[model samples]
Target: MPEKSERQLLPLADSDDRQDLRADCGSCFGLCCVALTFSKSSDFPVDKAAGTPCTNLRQDFRCGIHQKLRQKGYSGCTVYDCFGAGQKVSQATFGGTDWRQDPETARQMFDVFPVMRQLHELLWYLTEALTLPQTRPITAELRRALEKTERLTEGTPAAVAETDVAAHRADVNVLLLRTSDLVRADIRRKKKDRRGADLFGARLRGADLRGVTLRGACLIAADLRGADLRQTDLIGADFRDADLRGADLTGSIFLTQSQVNAAQGDAETKLPPFLARPTHWDRPGP
Candidate 1:
């Protein structure tokens, strides 16, 4: 949410907060590290197959090398967010019966976790869409979608395992697209259109980028100082070495922690309060 929008909801903060969509690792069954496969890449140090737990994963579901993941070349784990699906599948969907306690159900538990995760991710976005007052035109539709998605998250294990998450995502995307159009209509003027463009090393300082869709764009090392990126869709955009000093991303959608961590930002950079400034971000050069 924009900082101003954050302030607007301060009174209703307790009621509307989406903390439920965030991972609660302690309550999780190590679903992410076990159910997701990783190969030898910049993210993971060694290859691990899906359904096999990472060596660092402990019996209690905590990562033994949690603090040293990045130092040990497991940078991927640090950026992963399960949207609170782990605990839901661990406790709610399976009625708190762990895979270890009931080994026969292990495979089904693993299968359901990812599906639930996808559902929760959609819920996270839909919940945020509801928060935007600028999207009042289709707020009622978003509410219905939210209720529908919420009910799906409560489905039985068999139903979750058989769910068509991509189809559901497509249904929700319609509302989100409308919301985007309504929000961006005002700033369409004097804005750059760089949707899906390869902007690697491009110099884009102080540009008007309100409502631009930079989805999946390679923005590696781009100079984006003081840019206006309100409501820009930045999902999957590579931000490694990209300078974000003094940029305003107040209402940008789909800007994740991993993307922010890969970029360069400073004290002057404005961001949504939910995203913490990367600990490794550079100090201003004198």
Candidate 2:
């Protein structure tokens, strides 16, 4: 297992790094509660339309049921992470003037929120790639991309709303794919390429999946108990309701906190230090 310092590489917070890419809800205006929509499913209890504030949103822009979201049938909210875009849109983009103060601003702010979220998500990935020794060859390009993305996020609301986000994302994804390849290149024999594969509800308990590319794969409700997942690429993978109990994922790349929160785990799950064990997860078995 890597040391705590090594685990801290993902959400790197050095002076040279850009502003935090992690969600700081306190500095946000509950954008996720209003700018995004949800549907009645196992993840959400009620259907919601975009641009409307959630009933649980308080006047102070905080979730009324934040602490008990999962308990209150709002599991989707619990696992949702905006990568700090909420605060960026609330404080930086809008200069701390909330949507309620101006109807036009409300519409524009909501429009820009999702765009900024995607930029910030890309920043998070580029920043992580810079922290890895494997990506040293592409460090210059990664840093350039990170700076470019940061600049894009700082644009005016109109500029942000009009950003060619899909085009930008396509460019950044090329770099991310390279980073993934560099990191996983030396992991023994040819690894499984399950990218975007549908493995929902598949039984994979105690499987050896080292250095595998599980990007965009659907592992929802899959049994991953005690699986060896080190060195795996988990970017965009869906782990909702998957059992991660006792799984070894210490060296996994691109595994975000939201993905981990949506899964089930236990104390025995060997995760990187940067990733916290979900509180709702069961305690280690005796």
Candidate 3:
């Protein structure tokens, strides 16, 4: 973990506020660098086994190649976000003691990182659901889920490590799926079921894709400008090099920052407020 320091806690506006989901790297111990493994692929340049720190990790837990990560075939690192998990594990769970100093505690810290990551991810989605006007019928339940998941994230390393993330995910997923139906009910077009489909480089510009289940779909390099993607379940969908300019993803579910970062988009792209347009996404193409 990085050295512990004072971190400011922002006021939570409401149950829907996602301020807690933002990664606080400044206060984190570079858990992503030392805890997670990477493999040689199009996204990463080399194979890094679990429990081994990447060579680019700095003494202060910052990436030595951060600015040029994408240029150097470390695009995977550029897109990865811990969803505020790293800091929570470092500052709260372990009290800022890093693995380097307390070598014996390294394994437990690494174990807790992924569990906290999943819990935080759920918090992100639950908070997003609370913001949707169409999900008003389930807002109370979403709030309860959000609070419960948030509490789980704050548990001891042992408790977090033993959590049944899959079970909690299944429970929350039911509500998210229902939220999707409510949000896209008005889209009368034929709802596409592209689950696990290979739509790479497909020219889907201006297409009506509302209420679609694009789970695990490969959408790499697809031209989706001006497409209606409202209420789409984009879990595990690959968006590498996909054009999202002018596309409306207003009510999309389970979309993560990494997915948006891997795609191409611009100012006209309508996204959920929780996600930002990737800085590298200027005027875009492959």
Candidate topping TM-score? 2
C-alpha local distance difference test of each model = 0.79, 0.85, 0.81
Question: Stretches of candidate 1 above 4 Å error?
Answer: 1-16, 282-286
- Report clash pairs, candidate 3: 1-29, 1-98, 2-29
User: For model 1, how does the per-residue alpha-carbon lDDT over 221-245 read when each residue is reduced to its tens digit?
Assistant: 8999999888887766888779998
Give me the runs in candidate 3 sitting further than 4 Å from their true place.
1-15, 283-286
RMSD after CA superposition, every candidate = 4.8, 5.0, 4.0
Q: Tell me the TM-score of each prediction against the true structure.
A: 0.87, 0.91, 0.88
Candidate 1 whole-model C-alpha lDDT, 0 to 1? 0.79
**Comparing candidate 1 with candidate 3, which one achieves the higher TM-score?**
3
Which candidate leads in lDDT?
A: 2
